[model samples]
Target chain A: MNPLAEIVAITAVCVLSGCLGSLLGLGGGTFVVPILTLAFGLDMRLAIGASVISVVAGSAAASPRYLDEGFANLRVAVALEVATVSGAIAGALLAGHLSTRALYTVFGVVLAVSAVQMLRHRQDRDGLAVPDDPIADALSLHGTGTGTTVRDIRPYRVTRTATGLTMMTAAGAISGLLGIGSGAMKVPAMDLAMRLPIKVSTATSNLMIGVTGAASAVVYLQRGDVVPLLAGAVALGTVVGARIGSRLLAVVPAGALRVIFLVVLLIVSVQMLLRGLA
Target chain B: MKAAPGAPEAGARQVALVLRIGGGLGAALVLAGLAVSFAESGGGWLHGSGVDPLGGDATMRLSDLIGGLRHGRAGAIVLLGAIVLAATPAAGVVTAGYTWLRARRAWLAGVAVVVLLLLVLAATLGATE
Candidate 1:
């Protein structure tokens, strides 16, 4: 392929993926890897490498905007990081010992379960009365959503802290073992388990995904999986797309976001199941 | 229990500042590297010359980046940009930790430290792989 064409093509794909990634808190790898491999005919390793860079780029670029908008919960992010990072470390340690196919199968089932749960609670809004967990109380994870265009202010409380943390651990472990960001897992955990606002869940997941990606990106870099020109094109494109997506989040209704997330979740679940079976 | 007035806002601002700086620098470097590659290829880089003009060598270590920079390798410059981009979130985490400490939230600050340590561990594990 012509160097220029390659750069242009990859950038275009990244722009679309980055937009969706930031909008949905997915980090874009779920889309980028498959598109590069199946559509563009790129090497899988190369695609994963580029996906990692793109995920970091999209997450990092959009995060500041989310923070400014008060959609991202920093307290929740920090509290959950303890669980996700520990899961990631454990998964990394057990990476070689476990079977990828089996992990995929299990993760697919988990996603399916999460999708069902999300659907069942689609109408549930934040600021609802719920029993509080001791950990959430201690960490002060509850907050009032400010700086959002959707409402003047919506105060929300955290619940089922232990469940959310457990889900985060599993999410992190999946990412560590599969070398994916697994934002799909993070958003659902926050929204369904911790009972955070959907926007807050998405935005905070956006921020957290970048932090998790930073760790494995080094491995990809050292292993020579990252092609500089290719990954650079991806990084550049995702940043631009993420900026656009972040602005869109202020207007995109939470109900609509939930629908989009469900579609993405189902698609990802089926894809993982197929891969595992294959 | 409630936090100090505007504590979350203050923390968010600090984290945002770090992210903007890191993300901006990374994007600029990537753009610059692309420009250099275009210049080296004399506009044929994007137009499809028979030879690949922008192929970058895979760098194995940080030291390799310095060496590549001395040679003005476009790929290395881009790789460095990507690495910086990847590192931005971790930097944000560190900044958040500092913010937590300033708020006198020892537990949250300690959580930040543990997160950082885990990140380093994950990186080290990857490096060994």
Candidate 2:
């Protein structure tokens, strides 16, 4: 492809994927990697390296703003990082030696499962109403109402610490292995297993994915899995795409956004499977 | 927690808008630079046998892609640097945009940025080989 054409293509993909991901609460990596590898014919390792860079860039960019708005719980995020970072390191090391076929198969399966889960629970938007454990009270993982009187002062507590941590470990491992941000898995786990509010779960997961990506990125760098030129390109595209998507968030309806997300996931899963088989 | 009644909504909107435009432009510049350089290099030079900074085959090693930019055509090096600088902020712009559009979930935006970066890296690096 011509330089201009390639640039436009990548930019379009990134922007669309970012929008869908944000709407559905998924990491763009799940969609981005498959397109690059299957549609664009790039190698899996190279795609993974680029994806990792983009994940860090996106996380860092969005984090401060969220923190400033009190949407992100720094205390909870920092506490979780201890587990995520370590898991990422192990996952990255494993990624270096894993067969591309295996990686794709696993990634495809995960995407399919995640898609089903999203579809099944599409109507459940209510946040946790009651604290299920002492840790949640101590941590103050509660939600305060901004305008509404009926749902004012909703407190979100971590009911299942052990389960949440275990899920995080799995999320971190997937992140390192496939070079995906894995927020899809992490957010849901936190929400369902630990009973965190959707907003808090999303913010906390975002805070932690960067740390996880950083840990694995180092491993990829050492293993010679990361390509600077390619990484640079992906990082650039993701940043631009993410910026566009973030801006459009308010104008889009929640239902429409969710549909877009499901479509993207379906397409990505097929692409990953095809790439792995090829 | 409820915001104190009478918080500055206008100010917050202004800040968000500013962040969006600034971050978008930065990311675009980086992608443009990488696309230009990768095209100019014809994607063949990345695979040509050459000694990289790591003292290994430049084609197979990721380090070579990073460490070997200086050794490439001078124009390519400049483009590479521009791409890296621009791409970082682009990530922020993309994330913010996503947050505005969908769940307003900050992490999803972060994930978007990271994934885009990885795609760029893979394309540019893999093309070299």
Candidate 3:
């Protein structure tokens, strides 16, 4: 591939992925990795490497904005980090050993699962729901998330603390293993299971994904899977795209977009699965 | 149990600051590096250029990648960017960890410490191995 063309291709991929990721409140790595592998024809490991950096870049671009707006729950994110970090390290180490076929299969399965979860997500009822769990009480997870343009400061309680942590552990492992930020898993665990607002879940997931990627990034770097130029293109593209997506969030309805991305992901996953089997 | 009125905001700001700086710097360095590669080497970046991204060379180490940034090679700059990109999250861990520790939140601090250590260990092992 011509270096310029490669850069252009990757940058374009990240931009699209980043924009959609931010708009849907999902991180870019999920989309970026598959696109890098199936469409761009990068090796699975290489794609994973670039995906991690792009994930970090996307998170960096959006975390501050989300945090300032009071969407991410810091305490919840912190507590959950325990599971993700540990799981991520293990997953990172594991990815090094897994065959390319295994990675593709895993990636396909993950994307399919995530797409389904996204489809099933329903906006929680609007109310002042106080958390009844002791852990929530201890951590003070009940609080108000300052709204974006379309919403207001919504007060809510986080429940099923143990479940959230456990699910996050799985999400982290998947992230490290596949090199995709497990925002798909994190959002559902928080929004559906723990019963937090989707906005808060997504924001916190965005922040946590960076840390999760960092955990695996070390392994990828050490293992020499993260190609500098490729990762660079992804990082730059995702950062730029995420910024644009965040701004567009106020007016764009993401529900329909989510359906479209899910379909795209499903098709890509099938191709990826065939590629893996081949 | 509510936190102080401004505490969460302050903490969020601090974390946000770390992310913005790390990400922005990383992006700038990477872009600058690509430009320099083109300028000095004549479309070097547009072809099979930028240091080989594979192999066990010690030069690829994080510390060395940062060290190379002083010489102004585009590849080094990109590597430095990657390092910076990777480090942003670690910085977040430290910021959150230290803050929670000061507040006597042992669990949060402990989680942060463990994560930070793992990252350092990954970098260290990658460097040595």
Candidate 4:
């Protein structure tokens, strides 16, 4: 494809993915990578490099809004960053040694799993009204209060911090290997295992994912896997797309948004699987 | 509850202009650095020693040192741009958080965040490549 045309196509995919990802509280990179690799026929390593750039862009574009809204708990995010950053470094290092074929197969499976989870967890119900543990209190896992639009911010406690950290480490490893944001796993682990409310988990995950991507991105940079032209294009596209997606949240109905999210996940999952098998 | 109207509007316009100039300059510097390195690497003729404008790398026995500088410069420029890009989202969260803390104009802040995110996404995507 012509360079300009390729950019335009990738930008379209980035915008669509960001819009749905934001709505579903999933990181846009999850969707962006599959599309770039499968649909565009880009190499997995290159796709990963490009995906990291997009993740950084999307996270940066979305972070301010979440922080402004008091939805992001900086203290909680910072604490989690320790785990995420460490995990990211490990994962990134591992990625360099993995075979491309193995990476694609694993990525395809992860995508399918993510799609199922999104489909299964359709309703946005408030979690346990109050956190009931020491870990939650120490980490400030509880929500302050609910918003007018989203309802009351429910406080959640970490039932098993070790478990959550382990999952995060695994997620980080996958992120490095595949170049996906791994937010799909992080948010759920935080929300369900750590017992954080959905919104808090989502925002906090967004904050941490960037650090994870950064750790892994450095590995790619050293390996010369990241093409400057491709990274630049994807990053530029994702930032703009994430901005639009964030804005559209207000007007779009939450239910409809969830459906869109599921559809995108399903499509991307299939695409990845096909690409891997091919 | 309207702003002393014109004053707020003027301030808003000023902020917009600042953001525009900041974003444009940032993108330009990033692109230029990348182009220069691409040139020096013999990656292509448009940016190589044959037509080298940035002489540091393209024409030097100290080519390794110049190459290192180019790589470092490109990395720094890209990192800064990424941070600036990420700030838009952080700003939204901050704005919303502040409004919630203040207990006023919460909806306005929410709407602003959504708008800002979309605008950033559109502009970034549109400008790709």
Chain B alone vs. reference chain B, TM-score for every model: 0.79, 0.34, 0.71, 0.37
The top-ranked prediction according to TM-score is 3
Any runs in candidate 2 off by more than 4 Å, and if so which?
A: A122-132, A137-154, A274-278, B1-129
Better of 1 and 4 by lDDT: 1
Instruction: Please provide, for model 4 over B1-129, each residue's C-alpha lDDT reduced to its tens digit, 9 standing for 90 to 100.
Output: 110101111112332233344434434544564455445443333322243212122211111224645667453445445434434333433433354335554443443344344334323422231
Candidate 1 CAPRI-style tier: acceptable
Q: Which ten-residue region of model 1 chain B has the weakest summed lDDT?
A: B1-10
Preferred candidate (DockQ higher): 1 or 2: 1
Q: DockQ ranking from best to worst?
A: 1, 3, 2, 4
lDDT of 2 by residue, B1-129 (tens): 322322222123333344345444535544554555557654444553332211122212334445445565433342344334333333433444354336454443444454455434433533343
Q: How does model 4 do on interface RMSD, in angstroms? A: 13.0
Error of 1 at B3 (Å): 23
User: Can you give the lDDT of residue A182 in candidate 4?
Assistant: 86
Query: Candidate 3: DockQ?
Result: 0.37
lDDT of 4 at A125: 39
Better of 2 and 4 by DockQ: 2
Model 4 / residue B65 / CA error / Å: 10
With candidate 1 superimposed using the best TM-score fit, by how many Å does residue A233's alpha carbon deviate from the native? 1.0
Q: Which stretches of candidate 4 lie over 4 Å from their true place?
A: A122-131, A145-148, A151-159, B1-129
Per-residue lDDT of A73-95 in model 2, one digit per residue for the tens? 54455445545655666677677
Tens digits of per-residue lDDT, candidate 3, B22-127, equal: 8899889878866675577556545656543321231243555655677765667887788788889889778877877887877667767877776776666555
Encode model 1's per-residue lDDT on A130-238: one tens digit a residue.
Answer: 9858988887788866423455466778899899988888887766555566787898888877887777888899998888777667666755667777778888888
